[model samples]
Target: MKLNTVENLVRPVFPFTAIIGQEEMKLALILNVIDPSIGGVMIMGDRGTGKSTTIRAIADLLPEIEVVADDPFNSHPYNTDLMSEEVKESFNSQITLSQKKIKVPMVDLPLGATEDRLCGTIDIEKALKNGIKTFEPGLLAKANRGILYVDEVNLLDDHLVDLLLDAAASGWNTVEREGISIRHPARFVLVGSGNPEEGELRPQLLDRFGMHAEIRTVKDPDLRVKIVEERSAFDQNPLDYVESYRSTQDNLKERILAAQNILSDVHIDYDLKIKISEVCSQLDVDGLRGDIVTNRAAKALAAYKNEDSVTIEHIETVITLCLRHRLRKDPLESMNSGDKVDKVFQKVFQ
Candidate 1:
């Protein structure tokens, strides 16, 4: 089966393993896959920094999910709550489950997408032609248990941003139209990338992301040349380049799956938890989100490292990602938000 549903013309993506630099962005994406409740990732950076490419490449590495056959929402057969009332009734009489080795869906939410298209719509054709009320699943449905990637996310309309934030928070999408209402599971890892120069995301929407990563061009001449060389080789022969990195990608995938399996069992240290809370308070972060996301991110990092318990090191690894986007901008401070996070981290954890 295809990894992700092909909603548009397809293109060969740069291999995730082959991409050089931007390790933080990659880690944030992987952690979300391991435990999606960590919230989605927001990658803010300059153009040509592989932000979009990294999001696309992740689709190739994710494992397939077991879902109900032909389910529009990719609903798991065993999760009755995720199913619609009609579907549950039908399942009472008969139940069928299928394993689809699909690409972890990486759905693009275009700037032009309307509410009707992003959220499911009433089936006008069925209503007019057959006198039946039906629901036409939309992009959110396709993104269930997957990634909803928005390029230039800062440029998205305020209303659309609000809609996405609501769905991200509630893990459900309910569409009401003409006396017909449809509800379905819309849980997804919301991956958004944008050049900060284009615009700033709404503060409310920005806070919804679980982790934030900043990407920039490689500065070192040697690394820059290597990045160019790798790109040239991939362009010269996409298939061959992908094959060369296949083993590394497979290994990483295995690690991610293992991490997911043990994520719940990974213990959070009480002292570390206190440190996390104290750090958030010191940073003057808006709400408890920083503490919550920091805890979750550290747990994910521990899981990624196959550690049974979270450590100050694990918390340090993720504190920046969890709090960078939530910090209030200080005009008098010369340091950027990320830099501020680093300074605070040094003081709090040192």
Candidate 2:
């Protein structure tokens, strides 16, 4: 089967609207989509609270991206790779083909993945036979310009985490070994999830994430029953369940596209910007990335609400989602990050 057909079959196509309540987590993911440069979000909480579900649902909400046909990396036609002599000849000679509306790539990085598997390795047989270095791209290469999800990310090997952070920061990956040097685009929105009890992510790795959300199992009896019932019904008839919510999902897809266009025109008043910066400053976030992400998220919130301008309410709503994970650790303090953010919001936004 062709790759696109295979993707549609294996990729779990979940409707964004079908997900149960987890508003903050959902909104943060949407904002990252609006502006991928905002970096990726880390969803930390207890297991079975739908962290994976939320990440999977995001695929349905995104519009299909156009890519070069048969390129393992989904290299854009305008990419630097096209500047190479071989690729340039192919393009100039009209030997390249264009792809259609394929599903957005959302690849999972499993815990036990090997370094060679995560990053491309030299194709030994091909290199030996042809006497030329040939590269085999891996997960990071395949995940270009899309979501790279790492479940149980805190448990990932230290070297793997370092590789991820380096690629994320540079937006490109370079490999130099055994008479081969190749660099390709590796930009992606990094989404990670883990239970804190398993193991805590290192501070360096933690700081790379732009936003963090905590998802707890719903405690309310009524909500819990509804969640169980929905899952049961869906499993009994997956296609019918998916078909029923198809329109709702389509509507959300349109909204995301509209929000992307509107985001450029969405203005933030000076007062609101100052308030957001002040909240981050008061929290003593380690870098300016915190303030920048906070402002971007607040603007996204305003756009999501169809507001022409950002308001103090938007700032208040986004403050916690932006600063919670970036705060200094205080093991002796009993207060959670959310509580600390709430206290600050109440004081500043009021």
How high is the lDDT of residue 252 in model 1?
Answer: 93
State the lDDT of candidate 1 residue by residue for 1-350, as single tens digits: 55665643355678888889899999999888888899999999888888888888887678777676777888766667666555676677685555355566779999899998999888867777898878888999999888899888898888998888789879999998666677888889999889989988988789999999988888999999999999999899876888899899899999999999999899997877887888888889998999999899889999999998998888878889999999987779888887788888889888
In Å, residue 233's CA in model 1 sits off its true spot by 1.0
User: At residue 5, what lDDT does model 2 achieve?
Assistant: 71
lDDT of 2 by residue, 1-350 (tens): 45667545663455779888999899889988877767788889888998898898896678888677677776666555423334455677877557544567888998999988888888767777898778888898888878899999998998998898788767777776766677777878889899999988887678788888888889999999999998888788777888999898888888888888898899998877787778778888787888898888888878777787888888778778878888889989899988998898788888
Model 1's C-alpha root-mean-square deviation from the true structure amounts to: 3.3
**Which one is best on TM-score?**
1
Clash number by candidate, in order: 2, 0
- Per-prediction TM-score: 0.92, 0.89
Give the clashing residue pairs of candidate 1, or none.
Answer: 3-102, 3-103
lDDT of 1 at 241: 84
Poorest lDDT segment (10 consecutive residues) of candidate 2? 79-88
